[model samples]
Target: MPWKELRPMSQKLEFVEKAIVPGANVSALCRDFGISRQTAHKWLRRYRDQGYLGLVEKSRRPASSPLATAEDVVVSIIELRSKHASWGPQKIAGVLARRLGPEAPSPTTVARVLRRLGKVKRRRPAARIWSVDGRPRIEVKASNDLWTIDFKGWWRALNGDKCEPLTVRDAFSRRVLAVALVPATTAAHVRRVLELLFRKHGLPSAIQSDNGSPFICSRSRGGLTVLSAWLVSLGIRIVRSRPGHPQDNGGHERMHRDLSELQLSPARSRRAQQRQCDRWMLDFNHVRPHDALGGKTPAELYRNSTRRSLSPLLPTYPPEWLTRRANKAGYVRINGDQVFVATALARQLIGLRQESELRWSARFFDVDLGMIEILPIDHAYLGGTVMETVTTVRPSERARERIPVSA
Candidate 1:
C-alpha cells in the first residue's frame, strides 16, 4: 500500500517524463503507476520546479521555538525563591501555573533558568545517619492490616503522676482510634483500650507495638506479655519493632510526635489533656487533610472492614470450657479457687484448643486469649482446630491462695 513498494527510479522517471514534461497528461501517467492523479501531479510539479534534484530525499523534521520567560514573571519567581528557597519545583509550579497564569514557564524550565543563573542554592545533602535497612519500609494500602500502638514516651506533669499517653492509629488511614491518659500503661490498661477499639471498629488483622514491658515483655518466658497473648487469641497477628528501634513503628511514632507537638504540649491538667486530645482526634480524623491520604481525612479512607463484630458480651460456647466466672477483681473463679490468665481474657470461660503436633491454646468465647504460652501449645499463637470438650481442671491450691479472698 505504500508508494515505496513500487520500483523507485522507474516510477519516478515515469512520472517525471510522462506527467512532468511539457506535453504530458497527468491522468494517463497516474493510471500507469497505479497512483492517484493528485499524487502524480504533486510529483510532477516538484520535478518541474527543481528538475532531478527535487526527486532526492530531505529531512522531515520540525523546528524548535524557544519559549521566552517574561522579564516580569522571571523577576517574581526570583523574588519568591529569594524569600523561601526551600520551596521546591512542584510548589512553585502550583503557585505560578495554577494560581498565577498560563504565561509562566513550566516548573522544569523555570528550574533550568534559575540553575543557569546560579540562583538555586547548592545544598550539601543532609548527612544520612546510618540505620538498620533490613526493616523494609512499606505503606499499608488499607486499614487494619496494621495498627501502630505505642505510649507517647512518658513525661512528668506538673503534678508528677507521670502521664503516659497511649495511642493507636490505623497504619493506612492514620485514623487516631484511642488517646488516653492512664496512671500507668500496664498490660491491663492496654488490653482495655484494645477492647474498646475491637468493640467499636472491629478487630484489625494485626497490631504493631514496641517491644517494651506492656506491649512486649522480654522477661516473659514466651517473649510476649498477657496483652500480646490476648491479641493472638483473637486471631490478630502481632508485630513488634526491633529492640530499641523507634523507626520500626514509624507511623505511630510520627503520630506521637505530632500529637505531642500540636495537641499535648498545650494542656496543663490531666482532665484538660484528655478533653483537648478528644477534640484534636475529632479534627484529625474528619477535618485535617492527611498528606498520606492526599489531604483527605483518615476517616475518608478507613471503613468497617471486619468479617464479624464482637458481640455485646463475649459469646458463650457449649459447656466444653471449664466454667470460671470472672470476679470483680478480674480473676477467674474456679472451684472456689482463682488463676488470673490475663486481664484482657478476664470474665470469660476459656477452652484449651488442640493444634498440630499435640499443641494447645486457651480461648475465651470465640476470641483467642493473648497471654504467654501455656505449655503444650504457645499461647501467643493459637494454631488449632476448634474442639468441643469441657475443661475439667480445677485451680491448684496455690493458685487459689493467690486469688484475693473477697466478700
Candidate 2:
C-alpha cells in the first residue's frame, strides 16, 4: 500500500522516512504519494540537510528586512516621548527631523514605534461639532490682527494668596503677550494688565474674549462690559464668544490649559508664581514648538503691531462734540438728568454731540454711546419746568426719537 498522503506534514515525514531507507526508489515514492519528482526531491533535500524538523513548515518571511525602521531612530522617538510626554508623534517626528536631519523616521513610523512601546493611548475621539451656524468666525490674517484674552479660573497659591491669571495671547501667532497674576478679575485690574500689554505689543485690530466679568455685562447694552467699552473707545472692536461656549475661544483655552499645567509645582507666594509665569511665558513664546505654527515658536511668527500704543488717556474728539468727564459715578448729567456711561470711562473724558436741540449723541473716542433724547417734562408738577428724563436707547433707533447707547 502507498504511504498515507492525507496530511502534508505527515506525508513529508513519511515520504522522507521511507525514501531515506537504503535501496528505496525516490521516483516510486513520489508517484505513490501524489507528489511530483521535484517536490519529492525538495523535501528529501531539506530532510537530509536539517533532518525531520526541517520537513515541518518553514517561515516565509525574508531573512533580512532593509525597509524596517532603524533601531536608533526608534530609540530617538522613545527619547523624545520621554522628554515631552504630551507631544504626539507628529511633533516628535518634527523635532527629531530638525535635530537628526532628513533621515529621521516619518510621523507614521514614529506612531507605530510608540504603539509597539506601549506609549500610544487609544482614545475614542469626541464627536466633532461642525456647525458654526451662529458663531462668529474671525479669520486671523496677521500677528496683531486679533488678540484673545481670558482669565484662567483663579487658584490659591501655597501662601494662601488668590491668583487669578489674566492671559493675553496673540490669536494669529499664539504669542502670550502677558500672563499677569492679578488679585482679582475686576475690570480695573484687568484693564491695567491690558494697558501694559497694549503698550508693549501695540494695539490689535480686535480683542476677542469670553462673556465674563470685565469682558461682558448682562445688564449692559450689547453685553459690553467696562473693559470692552474701553477697547471700543480705542477703535479696537470687541468680540465676545457666545455664552457657555468655551470652544469659541478654543485656542486661548488651550493656552490656559498649558499655563495650568505649568503650575505643577505650586509657588508659595504671588511673587514666586509671577516669576514662574514669566519664565513659562518666555518658554512658550520662544522655546516650545507650536504644531499649528508648523513647529515654529510663537515668537518666530509674531510681530509688533504697526498701530502705536496710545497714552491710555481718553482719545480726542472733534471740536463739534462736547467733552465731559465720566464722573466717579459713571454718569454724565445731561439737561439736569443723570445718564449712565460705563464705569470703565469713570473720570475719563467722553464726548457728547448735540445732533439737535432736543437730541444729543454721546461718544467715547470714536465709538458712539447712543443718543440722549430730552424727554418731555411733567407740566403738572413744577410750573412747566423741562427737566428732561431719559431711558436707555438702542443703536437701531436712529430716527425713532431715541439714541443708540453703548452698554
TM-scores for all candidates? 0.44, 0.54
lDDT of 1 by residue, 103-134 (tens): 76688977876887888788854421212225
Return model 1's CA RMSD, one decimal. Answer: 23.6
Candidate 1 runs further than 4 Å off: 1-139, 156-161, 262-266, 307-407
Query: What is the per-residue lDDT of model 2 for residues 168-267, given as tens digits with 9 covering 90 to 100?
Result: 9999999999999988778899988888877787899998887678787754444566777778767797777877799998999988988987567778
lDDT of 1: 0.64
Candidate RMSDs in Å, in order, are: 23.6, 25.9
List of clashing residue pairs for candidate 1 = 229-370, 229-371, 230-370, 233-368, 233-369, 234-368, 320-389, 320-390, 373-379
Model 2 RMSD, rounded to 1 decimal: 25.9
